[model samples]
Target chain A: MAGIIMEIVQKGWPISRIKKFIYLGFLLVAAIFTVLYIVKTNPINYVSDKLPFTLGNEKPRFLFSIYGSGMNGGLSKPMDVTFVNDRIYITDTGNKRVQIFDRSGNSVGLFGKAGNKAGEFKFPYGITGDSEGLIYVSDMRNANISVFDRAGSFVKILADNKQLNKPGGLYISENRLYVSDIAESKVKVFDLNGKKLLEIGKAGRGKEELNSPNSVSVEGNRVYISDSGNDRVQVFDTEGKYINTLGFENNSKTSMFVNPRGIGVSGGRVFVASKVTSYVFALDQNGQKIFTLGGMGQEDENLALPNGMFIDEEGRIYIVDSANQRLVVYQN
Target chain B: MKLTRLSLILTLSLALVMAISTAAFAAQAIDSGPVKGDGRSDYAATPKNTTTTYPGGIYLEYDANGVAKDIHSNYQRNTDACASCHATHTAVGASLLQWANVTDTCNACHDGTITTTYDVVYGDFANGTRTYGGLFGGTTEGPNSLSKHNVGEVNIAAAPGGNSAGKADGFGSEWGKSFECSSCHTPHGQGRNFRILHPDVNGLATINRVKGETLTSPDNLVFSSLKAPWLYGRPYNSSNFSDSTHTAVYVNGVKQLTGFSIDYKTGKVTFTSPPTGTVTAWYVPSFKVTGDVANKLTANEKVTYKEGFNEFCGACHTDYAALTRGDGKRLTGVYQEAYRHAFGFNYSSGPNKKGLVFSNNAAKSMTNEFTCMTCHVAHGADQTWWTDWKTKSGWEGIVSGENAGSSALKRLPNMATCESCHEKGKGDYTY
Candidate 1:
């Protein structure tokens, strides 16, 4: 290449012409760089690569993936999911109802819809059951949390008005119900009855401030709130005493919760579902991470927007694979 | 000077000898395909190398077509325990560490890889100075500048520039600005299908913005690669102006002296000015272009100056002529006067008479370049900008002027520099 270039130069090209050629060369290089950069940004709809499902370094196994018909044809935006007695209850958010299925993926029953009346749900996003088989759903748009019996009977509504603006996630611990409110940016505590207890943290990015507080899960006397806007998790005691903060970084990967709408703390672990990364990170007792699971795919195991997660006493992991429109169960 | 026939013969002979010896030593031939579990040869860099063995090493074996033949890393294999080493850490620094000092732990094995005899060439190896290798290759620095891992100088504890404030506090010499063996090249072996450090280091495979390109998207836009947010001729004022640090200021035409970083909570911009010049309005740069004038960017746009609707400093530095003529040469004030940082210019809203501001002052604690890497780490198979062979740990070389930020910026160590520019809302805290 150098010899060929030397021969061309030996032909005695004019300096002006040579300078023009250099400018042309630069223009060509710039054109190439621009084209490369433009081609890099392919718009949405062109689905990116479906990264392999990896929990830490483990290939998410198929403990069992049951495929059976459902009552609503197929799940649509299954917002939040919970597991109890081999039964999986999912908050079909877009369907405006709750669908119950067994471990075998067989539909057991369905309840709730877009209504302000009792027993009905409007934008249901959170699901959790109590020891007495009492189901609690975060009726987000209604700004109230409704309770129903295992038989799908309306039990009660424990919140109303600005107090529970867009209640997204619910967890029952020590007879106290913790409700994660998105708009209000605080977790409204209440008793089994419709009586409000104490409100914790206003909306802001501080140790105590909650920004877009989406989900809550209580372990012992501690409640963990996903401070979505702050890109961190705020931990507080049952009495509203701020304990500590977790996942404090602006990076996309190291983030524990970015728009995290649902949380489940069980077996001394906290599972945070990040709406941005679409991964469920498991944290230990001290909020130390055990592992991060899930990826972006529509397949049964892959998560799209995992809004809610539930861990059974048996250590089985269940996720409401929201955008994928289905329920995913990860059994040990 | 032209080479004589004899000289050419001698050069050719030397080149041939060097190429032959380099090729022979480079190819530490191994069994075809990726290494196997516990297979010590598995740790040896293979041709189409895949599968590395480490505690919780996420392994993925891909065929020539790039389809995943197998994925035993991340979560499949029991060894996929990232939390084992990179535990749930939430300090103000880099989390995810089993032991403290990352370099000390990595050196236990890499120090043995380097072989030196009578004299040390790279650095003071005996005094604990050493170098590392590139991604995939066994040797430290390869012959070609491109082929080499480009790991920069490693500053050990004895070294002056040790990262004392790093995640590993006083544990040992921290991996400084320079790249190390484990920087991009995870010592535990690359389990990522795309070869990132963590699961989403670079980005997920499915996160494509265009066809064929796996790891490219708008979210991947690094601040360093793009033009700076040019806030051209916008109203700006601050409440915290004092006559101390900010000794000189000019609003529209009046001459004043005041400098203060805004604190939104108190609605004040704290600047120390001399006890003279009165506080006046200033023009802050726009954070994002809302109109065609602010956003109309084109190709080969000169970095220095341009005519209409461009981000050249010359646009506002009309005073550039006046200043240069008054003095004999260049002045740095060209940036401070024409360019601004804290004032609001984003589409959200600009600072008003209330003395509000939007700057990264809220996060004054952070360091490091706040460009793309501030929020994005390259080589993360799941969360980085793109995949390049050069992305092995710490091998990130100097940026080409074309690829640099508005000021031909080099990367900083922390996220503070970013806040110096991208802070949101008046004052430090947005609360």
Candidate 2:
């Protein structure tokens, strides 16, 4: 190749002509890159129409909504909802009661009332259920968790003010209950019998720390917490070991969360209800963005300060739209 | 020659790519449904994606159209703060509050779960940690004495100075209505008054004034056609102008500082010389302070009182409020010694040289006028010592009968609130 270039130089080729040829080659390569860049950065190409059920692109089908109080099946600031034994148990916070309903949007039977008695609730914020049809509620104002039987009867109370201060969200899995103490900014794990097992996180914006965590969900050996005030999600092992952090806007490719409240892990996706933005963000197990549900509005599709979320075995999402005073159901 | 042809081909390809990329950028600008899952659509709409951060780490995000998506405690337009107190669809109370009553709704956040700054029930730093509003429903004052304001009481009796026959407004008619938190504070944060105090309390409009005025004079010196009476010596408006300060005068959009003298009561402006351009004045119609002024002041700081507070209190207590110097001399129709104590007087340089508790120390000097808040607490008075003394046998001359040591929201209990400044019965008492 060097000998041929030397022979061509010896031949009568002009210097300006060689320079022109080199410039043409550079221009051709630049044009090809520009075409590729446009196609890569195009917004339409980011989400494909062909993949309809993709995490971020799929739209949830509205199932039904339950609202109102007493005979009208009404609720006042219903904070949390859970599915158990084919029935829905809602912590009717404003009325200071636990309202129960059937799957078809019918009021089944209700329990609890406004007081500090064995069954009453001051501010029931989070709710969860177990396989044997037992329900657990996080009474925020009373700073305790109230347990009730499947028949809407008072069973007992767990984790009073001594163990919890402003307990907000609850999750029950594998005979272990995970409770997020909002004031203390800690996640306390307890057995079904109200025995403290493991404690996770402290009040800070660090990696192993949480700031006003709202909800907790257990998927296998991992525990997912909505670190609300920090605007992120912290994942920990069942033994309370910090695994990873997600949803901080400062992290590249992550969406901004303002006061994330409710969280649920279902179908390999983690769903978080952002309180101030009124949107539910879905993320994959690896903390990659999947999709978002609803925005801030009064419409059927919109949500207002959604507090608690529940995902049943059937892949149906029950959102406690607290500010809207209703429970909105969506099919995944 | 071949190189030149190749160069032309390369240039054409570059132009083609540029054209297609421009079209693609424009096509991407289309709105893609509602939910912003991928962050692409959200980023496209809000290119900068700016956020306005408030106290307590509360922040609001503006949408693509530059409208605030959700507002928390800031209480600006299109606020989600409404949902904080009221549940629109499942309202359990009269004003769409999810709770059974207005006080319950206020107590929900004020109980210190959400914020300890405005804990009204336990009086935690609500007014700079002084418990200025007093405790609600507690045994601070003996076991039997409830001395606080009956906030949630239904069908209550008339106010002490309430006159239903004297004023035609709803102030007089509010006698039997359920006295609640909404009676004083407008929850939606609508009023220009301090602490979101309702501009129109009961039926009386406490603060009234022309917002903006263009002054015109034949000789270009005096302009006096103000539609309403302006608040004197109180900088309630944005311009912060009172009689002591000049009304915000603008000559052709430039602020004029020295050329005008304003008559606050008459709503008149007189200029020093003939002005060539158009003269305009911007002033608030009533003595309305920006909301939450007291929250910004320190505990020991004194708030300067000028005017308008008497009118604000007089809206409900019409017979007791002395609107003017002449009105202070008589007890309405009876013409006896003034039944009500004098207000709106500058007590800064009086026999009582010590300054009293004022409204806010934002601007202006401490005039120390005898506003209603000077001798009273807005919520309730919890003085256990005074309640114990009044219930005993020896305090008959000072206070007696069923109303004995009721406190009536008095600041210092018994006549000590009066004696602290007046020094008639005892020597000058300190706060």
TM-score of 2: 0.57
Q: DockQ for all models, in order?
A: 0.01, 0.05
Tens digits of per-residue lDDT for model 1 on B155-196? 222121223333333222232333433443443333321122
- Stretches of candidate 1 off by over 4 Å are A1-69, A84-86, A249-256, B1-431
Question: What is the per-residue lDDT of model 2 for residues B1-431, given as tens digits with 9 covering 90 to 100?
Answer: 65445445555676698899998655544422335432322442222334642211122333332111211233332233344446568776655665434564464345433322354544433122445455553412233233566677643234556653333443433445556777777654333345556544653432333334675552543434323233333332335454333246677776666756666444566667767767777654443433133323234422343435666666666656634333345655112234456765556654442223544323344445566777776666554433433433334344322245466766555565665577686456795
Which consecutive 10 residues in model 1 chain B have the weakest lDDT in total? B301-310
- Looking at model 2, give its docking quality level: incorrect
How many Å off is the CA of B56 in candidate 1?
Answer: 42
DockQ top scorer: 2
DockQ score for model 2, please?
0.05
Pairs in clash, predicted candidate 2: A56-A290, A68-A74, A68-A75, A69-A74, B208-B285, B209-B285, B303-B360
Candidate RMSDs in Å, in order, are 34.2, 18.4
**Residues A87-110, candidate 2, lDDT per residue (tens digit)?**
988888777778888998788888
lDDT of 1 at B171: 20
